[model samples]
Target: MPRTPQPRTAVLASADLSFRTRVREALTGLRWEVQEAQGGAEALAYLEARPCEAMIVDTWLPDLEIQEFLAECEKRHPQTDLIAVDDPGPERGPERTQARSPRRNEVLLALRRGQDADHEPQGDGASWNGMPEMTPVHDRTVVREEIFVRGTAVVEATRPGAEPGPGTVRLPELIGEAPAMLEVSRRIRLVAPRAATVLVQGPTGSGKELVARAIHRLSPRANRRLVALNCAAIPDTLLEAELFGHTRGAFTGAVQGRIGRIEAADGGTLFLDEIGEMPLALQAKLLRFLETGEVQRIGDNDPIRVDVRIVAATHRSLAEMVKAGSFRADLYYRLAVFLIRTPGLGERPEDLPLLVERLLARMAEQAPVRRLSAEAMERLRQHAWPGNVRELQHVLERAAILAAESPEIGAAEIEFGETF
Candidate 1:
């Protein structure tokens, strides 16, 4: 009898068991022995102990950064082909997928199968027994594919040095290409045309005010004034008057009758920042105004009618506050007619490169533009980013200053602030 060939061994490394199972099933019919590892450290250890023909790594790992792990794999086990899968979530597209294996079709098919399993609809007769058709091989160059979902509008990903499709909504103010940021832009477009109340919820420094400005700019009242009031900045004693205006001699320091923020924003929009910090008593007044579109000034008998769309933003959870009796339920419902949540920097780490580029370009307006070294970018990727995008801006500013005469910022110049 002739000698039999040994089965090629493959490793599936991920923190998600379902992802591993799906990929394993997809590769079942092939002549391969599949091994599972929970994280990068475990996978690395396995590769050292036993030789594998190929290894599939997840973009996120519990024990190591994806970039670091990939670099190590290249340096140590250069013979083993590597393929990394991004979070198979609906929000993220398969843009960063890279494969050097001759069995690239099998790898891509396995990836597609995993993604399909993730988005499998309930109670539908679907079969995964058939092999997926691979894209025709026209050239060695791989073109990027990006899907930006906006209200049933699918804009294909643009190639490098190519213009974006006309259907794409270009938001110059928002400097991120992450799925979370794309969703924010979609919501803005959907709600901007209407006069609905918008509640922007996010952690501090997550660009809530920027969302408000974008809404105002896109609204039908764009030609009119956009009046903003910081509910947390003004004292409770003066907030009511500042919001509803006050007649002369209404109270101490009431120099003259002035139009309040609401009145000033008539036919436009009124942005109330830190609305969660508003006093319960003032909440009642604000709710009444929202319900009737009327504002009653201090020492005034008549209630003035005002037509202003309300755009409120808060870092705190109004629902939790309502449960705690700090925020009124009725007012919360009124303000939260339409809600938009801004994701934290930690939630969308993939956008860091684009954000860094845009922020550095903006900083160039005041100073010479400085490029970030690969090591510096890797350092940024490892941070927790508890302060979100605002903190990123501050860090970059400090790094630029620290770089001094140098045109490029290095890892030594990148400093992170203490997280409370």
Candidate 2:
């Protein structure tokens, strides 16, 4: 019997998730498998752990010096082919990109075609071969930490307007090593860099917004603003103006033309919370903008083009709404290009201990950090957790405050608030 050849594996070392996503989406089905490195260090480590056939190194590596990394690769693994992807020219900001693939005419063609698919008309359109271009992963000059897990690399992006300082805390804490939590992280890795819209579905308080933030933090658009608007919190009367802006004479209260949330979030992400609550009329306008990338201010004839990524979250079932004619089927399909679900607290009880620890840590910044007794923890796990993580945090905060000057919170101190 003839032997089948093993598929070759390749490594992609880059801090830019957008670039990585572009390459992967372009080369959807090739003989070789692809792995990712958060930065040069992770890539080197991955290469050492198991030698691969090739490594695609991005120009702006966050963790290690690009030249030094290239030298190390050349010296350590002389046999592994190296293909460097560089920016086409100077890019202005985090999201601006003009990339050129390896000089070697190999798998890069697939990438070029994939990128062309992004800008070209949907179907029957071939990738533009005339311009040998790659999306530039621009202005990533800062150094940061790298975390490698399983077969993927994770790195924090430097966001504009919300840069973290030495004393600043990023996320309160993820607080889970369980499989469910790990899977959430994995999904973030897969979807963060892609330009596709992401719909995060979960019960209220299951940390859907947190998942959205994680995706933005890991995306190329991190440096740009992440505008979060709660559809349910805002009144239906004002939702239209809030989303699409209004010209000075459009409505009775309109004093001046104002850019709406969609316009404000250009070149970044717009997180729509409780999307199921958005009015059906507004859904039509939103669908128009999604289709044309153009927003028309209320009572304005001109349309404005704004580039924005949509990360929508809702506890309600949109599928049910679609069937019920509450949500437009077309708009639902546009928003759900990619989907991620946040598990409710009860679904992953094993994470309760870590969750308690993180919540207590967050509470410490406000008050003294307290420890949970086993009895208190057991009482927590015993509850149904109908409200999920948000409910848990509220209970813990109340308990911590009620504990007063005590160093330890007893089971009696843990109170279950009004059950959802």
Candidate 3:
């Protein structure tokens, strides 16, 4: 008997009902198990709960901005394939008619033709002196399809080893071979075995969370859960309940008993990202937990003891925040038992080529990978990655998409702009 084919998993994010229907139909034909989301935030939430093999995101969404959504996707699911789609406007003029042609078809044609130019009109048109004319157009359907296929293949090829079993959660493996990365790895190994609470400081997008995960994976609590909570992301009102569990009748809409993150990571590591944003009152509670290894669930009189280790990270300078009185000095002292400062992408320019190579290799699974021009690499190295490694990944991902329809990524394709 023949074995059944594994279902291709995908998350489709778009608010347009008709467009979503069409996309779903196309993916269904390709034997994909399609999950739908109305916007970027919803898409991200879906991905966080159950990561898919590939994500098809519309450039425009109501809830979250496009670039931000893509960045989050890259950070959370680096191995998953990403395909961005843009709408083709009315089919009126010569350009409009060409734009209306399926973008997936266009991308596929470009890849097949080994073309390095953007989509351009071909053949004769109504013109003075009856001359043939060609013009560039923007619909990239063929390219999108090619990208999807290539990305899916890469995800399969580089799927991380099976999910770490209970008491053995796997963390994000840092991706660089540069001297900076070597030092970071050495630091992680040195601090992993000890029960010290670690503080990871870096600029936003510098992969602070990734560094935290590596520490957890290498630490004595490697066999436990590595629960991560973004302090800045959680609202101040509910931050307390999120970090510490609340009883069924604790507060408004508290319908059921819930286990907070600290307790959930009982025998593992609790990674508090953007720890500087944690509220002043909550800081005291956290400090107490660290000192006594006990957490008191909200609305409960008793404190529950847990054996979890804490790994906190932040992009802000806590020392400055402490001076400003926005953050607690005592809490910082408790969390910073060990400190590992992560270097930004610009700080380690030597790793650009290796990082670019790995990104292209992953991108190749979605389309024919293209080689970066020397000028392109030089230009990339020159830019100050304020968003750090995350920004670099986005730039490369976008370049890959642009180059997937061409044979090479040129200086123009390496365009860098302001990213928040």
Candidate 4:
């Protein structure tokens, strides 16, 4: 009797759904079980949850840095065979994915061909572009797919390349083909046409402000002034006066009556940042204004009506704060009429290359063009990025300066620091 073949399990860590799909097609046979992860962080989570014999890291991960992910994968799961699809060419990378498999190259190559074929004008859900189409496959560990409404997209979002489809809204400011970021873009498009309040939630440096700006740009009041105020930045003693305006003699420093940010944004949008830090006392006043559309400047009994749409953002969870009594439940409900979450740098590792490219270009405007060596990029991808995209920009800026003598930033030039 023939001996039974042992079942081998593997993990595919990538933010690209199309890539994930292609891999599924390629590895159809060989009695392999697969686990899927969206980013490096999520990949680690999957690994922690269970062990797989082999793990494949796509050339670009959306969440955690790719180099860092590979390093950490090896360190934590040394027994798990690690495979990385090389940059500049994914076929070879997947070919490396062919490791130890009798028909490894065949499957990986077929996957690559299928991917390249996906780019053609194949009417929706058409054939796998003339490749030796393989049967559909699914992951043993469930995969999370980006939910897109009609006016939306997914991992295959049109970048500089990719066939354009109908109802596709392009947001060049926001880069990253990850599902999380794509969902955000879709939400912005759906809500931009409305005047509803949007509360953006995410960790610090997660581009909450960028999300707000995108919403404002897409709103009906795009031409109107966009007034932004950081509630946490202002002292509690003067937050009220700052928001609602203060009469000339309202306070000692009130040299002259001035309009508040809310009033300043009349007929436009008012962005309230760090709203979770807002005082409980002020929450009542804000709620009243939201209900009545009235703003009363300090020391003035008269209330001025402003037709401003409110868009609030915070790094902390207002829901948790509400339950803890730190935030008003009523106000939280009103402000969060629509919610949008911006993904952190660690969550969108697939965007690292684009971010590195875009950030370097911006730096190039003032300084000489700078490039990052493969190692430098790997260093960046591995980092946890608690500082998020903002930290990414700062790190690149510092690296560019440090590498001033050289045109390319190498791993030695890459530096990491913690910020409170």
lDDT of each: 0.75, 0.71, 0.67, 0.72
Q: Candidate 3: lDDT over CA atoms?
A: 0.67
1 against 3, candidate with superior lDDT: 1
lDDT of 4 by residue, 1-420 (tens): 999977677777654567776776666564667776654545665677787777777655432345545766777887676666543444444332322444345445645653574545554643322222211212231111222222122323222223334323435457666667767776775566467899999999887877877676555465577789999999999899889998888889889999889999998889999999999999999999999999999999999988999999999988999889999999999999999898888887988898888778878899988888999989988998889888889899888878877989999888887545
Estimate the TM-score of every prediction. 0.61, 0.65, 0.58, 0.61
lDDT of 2 by residue, 66-138 (tens): 5546666777887676665642322433432222233334556655653453444423453221222222324
Clashes of each: 0, 6, 17, 12
Name model 4 segments beyond 4 Å from true. Answer: 1-168
Of 1 and 2, the candidate ahead on TM-score is 2
Q: Residue 166 in candidate 3 has what lDDT? A: 22
Name the 10 consecutive residues with the lowest summed lDDT in model 2. 143-152
Model 1 residue 242 distance off true place after TM-score fit, in angstroms: 1.0
Off by over 4 Å in 2: 1-173
- Between prediction 2 and prediction 3, the one with superior TM-score is 2
Worst 10-residue lDDT window, candidate 3: 141-150
